[model samples]
Target: MLKKLLFLFVLAVLCLTFIPQLTKPSSTLVTVFKLTENPAVIVKGAQGSALTVNISFGEKEVEELLGQLTKPYPLLFVDSDWASRFPHLAEEIKKRSVPVALLGVQGQSYETDLNLFAEQLSQFEKIFAARPLWFRTADEEFPSSLLQQLQKAEINALGSTVQWKEGKLPKASKGEIISVSYHSGGRPKISDVKRLMESRTYQSVEDLLFRPTVKTKKIPQ
Candidate 1:
């Protein structure tokens, strides 16, 4: 009888220890930088009740857009190639104290040319006085080689869940990242953006990432 009681107790302890392990969900691998072709997948985080905005700065309209914005400025992904041609715009961005990311080379395959990539990176750093924390390709697709380079430089890849298309801004809900770009034929009207800002709270990329209330999820590579 004593032996049987001891055996049952041991069995109960083993079950208690191992049953949860068998039933619990597997831990997911969350990466700081998510590489995906799907934009929705990239912005999968608990965003509370605000929308995040990413503005691709390449044209004069961006300056007007900047003037219209108030507090909680959107992240401006400036085109390094364009900035090299228009230093005045870069200076304007610096003067405003707006947060910025690097919008990779435009109209050229800088990914394949290391020298060109290096030159652009150097030029951007010279103008901004700091390296960019985030980078996005013109088409939002990154080559593995270029991705590796960005990773080595500790730059995170940014993607948008919503985009302005066909001369209209897509209706986006809270917790979405909307990307507006002049190079992509989406010339955001200052009025339209201002209206959206009035309707909803907007957050920068840094705020979206580091917000204590927001919960981040693991996205598969």
Candidate 2:
């Protein structure tokens, strides 16, 4: 009787455990997407052109949307993967011949966000080789130890992040040929901008040829 009771108890426990897993539905893990805000913009000069300087998703629309207008607007583009992903849109942009400039953004004291942005950027990243603008940390809120590890890993084994900022970024080194996206805004003084590109050790060939300012050939009207 004792043996039978023990076996029944064990079987009952096994069934209880197995039944919940088998019958209960799987739970979904919730994930939230954090969107990065591009720089706020202020445009001056030609009111004629529809194109505005920015790093963004909808650039090719310039032609079909308002290319009909007599004034053809062009964008001052930044060199990054975000620009590369849309070959079709880029093709449209090519037709328009929009001005493209590399606008780098480096973090000042916001170390945590900088590193977090880099790692997160790679997952579905659309631009540049690695995260641009190597700041001290990606996430300012993250604990310091983790940040140290990330810094050591990238500096030692992994490659360096982009080290340029379009405007003012503090406490981070700037590199030659800094790459940025359209959304990166607030152009630095011509002299300061020129200095960063010149100071960096090396430049990507494209950047070396055309640093600071690059004029796009006008589209045939």
Candidate 3:
């Protein structure tokens, strides 16, 4: 009897150490960075809710990725830059007029980190016009607002593998340069303009315009 009990305990410990989290996706929104052509992952949650993401984890290539998953979340988390980073994609979602909720993340030890996050979350509240739900630790999981702000304030993008390519540095431009789509791509002399687009300044008004510069060429008539 003693030997059998010890074997069962050992087997349970081994199973716990070796097994992976094979549970299917659940219903929840996630805050994350932008996506690239390489396949992004699905953290998985309930489908068809407002996905107020902080970034687009997988740019436009999410179709194949989403199709492969047993549960494909149709929602776009549009609370912050996650959705707006992809300008065209954001516009498409807006055209559909889908509703989204802004979610914020607080860090662990909110007591030590409350004041700092308060300042950052002030801007988020202005943007969302409501308080955001906070997650204590990235691993802590369950949601709360106090934790959300703390996380955002401390979540620095220092040593991530995601290599951000800054195209044009904003420089002197006419009529308050609206967006990169507002000007041209592949130009190196427009960093400030890039900042404007990145900061969601271009999205304030409805008439933000973009068109290819037309040059008239003289031809024999």
Candidate 4:
């Protein structure tokens, strides 16, 4: 019985030794760099790995800012009036082949707001030649009704920030939210960006965004 017990202990030790450690947290994190009111200054000065940039369409020199985009980074368009204000930016974005997401309703209560949201979506579809699958909002809390409407509109993802949690970099696709880890002030370092770019989780999310949606196979009767 003592020999059997010793053998079991040895086997358990071997198993523990072979098991891999959990290096990352349970959630995946993505990092987003929001362009301040002065995007040109930020873009020109900022240094980091590949990053998704957020731009408000109504900002001045929108074309100039876009023309400066030499590298292919994801772009997030904020404000509902972007299409109406800068109708040609979409064409430029298409030429650049950048991923795009639009700002969505944030806890809108009135029916008029909903109507406006629909109008904005229609405009976006017309401008981009495809519906945007991702959205972001300023509100920390959202209504279920608003969420249902977004889902019904076929939005596949939402974006949030983990900047509040200092020293913690987020992984990609945490539930329905694509959480981003970025510095609140100044630009992130290139080394840090490189790490994010190299992560398997980030690559997985990228592949998911670019992959074509699966269609049901038709069976002949």
lDDT of 3 by residue, 192-218 (tens): 323433432222111111221211111
* TM-score-superior candidate, 3 or 4: 4
Output the better candidate (1/3) by TM-score.
1
Model 3, residue 24: displacement in angstroms? 44
lDDT for model 3 comes to 0.32
Task: State in Å the error of residue 17, model 2.
Answer: 91
TM-score per prediction, in order, is 0.66, 0.24, 0.27, 0.47
Please give, for residues 1-221, the per-residue lDDT of candidate 2 as tens digits. 99999999999999999998888755321111111122111111111112223244345442243243222232233324445656565455456554333222233332435454344335323433233222211111223333343344332111122334455642333322233222323333434434443433332322322222222211112
Residues 115-206 of candidate 4: C-alpha lDDT, one tens digit per residue: 65577678777777767655555332334444445556655334333322223456543221123322123334434544544442232224
Q: Which ten residues in a row have the lowest lDDT in candidate 2?
A: 40-49
Note each model's CA RMSD in angstroms.
Answer: 11.2, 18.5, 19.1, 17.7
For candidate 4, the C-alpha RMSD (Å) to the true structure equals 17.7
lDDT preference between candidates 3 and 4, better one: 4
Candidate ranking (lDDT, best to worst): 1, 4, 2, 3
Which residue pairs collide, candidate 1? none
Candidate 2 achieves a global lDDT of: 0.34
lDDT of 3 at 90: 51
Each prediction's Cα lDDT score? 0.62, 0.34, 0.32, 0.45
Report lDDT (Cα) of residue 63, candidate 3: 30
For candidate 2, the clash count comes to 25
Model 4 steric clash pairs: 28-171, 28-172, 29-170, 29-171, 29-172
